[model samples]
Target: MDSNLYRLFGDRVRELRETRSVTQEELARRVQLSRASITNIEKGRQRVLLHQLIEIADALDAKPSELMPSPQSQSDPTMRRDVARVVEMLKSEKSRSDK
Candidate 1:
């Protein structure tokens, strides 16, 4: 699979997850995946099966296609930054919860 495609998909997942205020751990639990697996999916380091994609989308109250980035949006730097921001926000939330 192409790295760029992976990135695009990952970003879309992260964005939707964040919009729904779902943490990685919660999503993982709902989807019956490990936290690491959720992290890998969001980081674009691991590929997801179609069934898993459907599960994730459902957990986030979204359609499967909503978890995908369009080719035009994939190349958009603003979209990447937005995803990065969501990651940072998640990290901050994690740290707060840990404390």
Candidate 2:
């Protein structure tokens, strides 16, 4: 949780939604998603899909990059842990295979 992308994502979505004078319900309707889904996105509880992000940006007349997390947050510490765990698993599998 380096820098907690949750805040960045939540703020960005709320800003974009407000700028367009769009309600969460309205945006949800336009995007064909549930209002709860839009709410989660604004709250940063859910990650948006690439295609859905693009569509949301288009609907808001914003650039898709506007929704992206910063480079630092993109390379999250959790991701490193996940990669290390996967590598360890692969090494164990190889060792088992060799025996």
Candidate 3:
């Protein structure tokens, strides 16, 4: 799939975020992400993982379904369940790619 699909998820993220009147820093703190990351997602520059989406939703008193692409449609099944592992792998991949 094209990255645009992830961009589509960004609007939902921004909506649930602003609906609660929470600051980006607060949301990022709750999710263990950087404010820049929250900005990126809200601006359609990065796609958040399922866990982060759920955390953000909870912080905003919303549902994960309220912040995600679709309840039935997700990024990847296994990666969705184990975000830490996937994040580490992605970091490793990035390091390797950057070399």
Candidate 4:
């Protein structure tokens, strides 16, 4: 995957984790990883395997697709907007679920 895509994926993970009020350490534990690994992953300094991606999504209570960045988001401004909109929607949904 493109580094930019990895960065986007990381950003999405951080957003979802924060929205769920989950700490990095907690997330790491859930994913059977170290806190430093979570930090590195969230920083886009570490690339995750496919299984790891699924594990992360499960840890966050999100779908794997939700954790992925749209391939076109890097090239298309409109797609980027769509991705941001979807992220915002997910945040809203999470908040509503908390209420």
Candidate 5:
């Protein structure tokens, strides 16, 4: 995945988390991840798994789509494809979780 995309996603996560007054440690606890993991995620130094992305979004009280980088923001075709793929996976995961 593109570093820029990761950064953008991380930035969104941090922004949303902060807006909700949630600390990294609290978010990690809610998501069942370590605090260090949350730190790495917010720093864009970690590649979040598909399930983890959904979990993080849920923990932050956000929709998965809200946590992702906008496909239109990417100039690279590969990045757009990557984002699209993740969006599809998020939809699938959400449906399953909702069941």
Candidate 6:
């Protein structure tokens, strides 16, 4: 997965976990993973495998797909253009600052 996509998925997982009032430690135990693993996933520092994804979704009482961002939303042309514009603007700012 793309880094941005991984981050988005991680954010979704965090949101669902919070909504279910589940702590990271508790979820870690349920999923048979370490709390650090959960933290890393929540922070987008780790990637989840298919089995882990299913375990997480099951623990949260959510569908696996619910842990993912909508493809359409992520692929929206307008959003892509906006992100590109922001990237260009940041680059321009950085170049000016470096000079």
Candidate 1, residues 18-98, lDDT tens digits: the string is 999999999999999999988899998989876677678779987666776774766565664564455455545655987
lDDT of 6 at 31: 100
Task: List the pairs of residues colliding in candidate 4.
Answer: none
Q: RMSD to native for every prediction? A: 12.1, 11.5, 8.7, 7.4, 2.7, 14.3
Model 2 lDDT per residue over 1-99, tens place? 434465566667778889889999988888899999888888778776545765676677776556555556665656545543554555456559879
Candidate 5, which segments miss by more than 4 Å at Cα?
71-73, 76-98
Query: Which candidate's TM-score is highest?
Result: 5
* Candidate 4 structure quality by residue, lDDT tens digits, 22-82: 9999999999999999888888889987667767887889876778766565665565556
lDDT of 5 by residue, 13-72 (tens): 898999999999999999999999888888888888878887888788777778876667
Model 6 CA deviation exceeding 4 Å by range: 76-99
Per-prediction TM-score to the true structure, in the order listed: 0.71, 0.62, 0.62, 0.71, 0.78, 0.72
Stretch of 10 with least lDDT, candidate 2: 80-89
Which sequence of candidate numbers ranks them by lDDT, best first?
5, 4, 6, 1, 2, 3
- Residue-level lDDT for 59 in candidate 2: 72
Greater lDDT among 3 and 5 belongs to 5
Steric clashes per prediction: 0, 0, 0, 0, 0, 0
Q: Which stretches of candidate 2 lie over 4 Å from their true place?
A: 1-3, 69-99
TM-score of 2: 0.62
Candidate 3: how large is its RMSD? 8.7
Question: Over the full model, what C-alpha lDDT does candidate 5 score relative to the true structure?
Answer: 0.81
lDDT of 6 by residue, 2-32 (tens): 6776677788889999999999999999999
TM-score of 6: 0.72
Identify the leading candidate in terms of lDDT: 5
**Candidate 3, 48-76: lDDT as tens digits:** 66556656766788755455455345556
Model 3 poorest ten-residue lDDT run: 79-88
Error of 4 at 79 (Å): 12
The whole-model lDDT of each prediction reads 0.77, 0.68, 0.68, 0.79, 0.81, 0.78
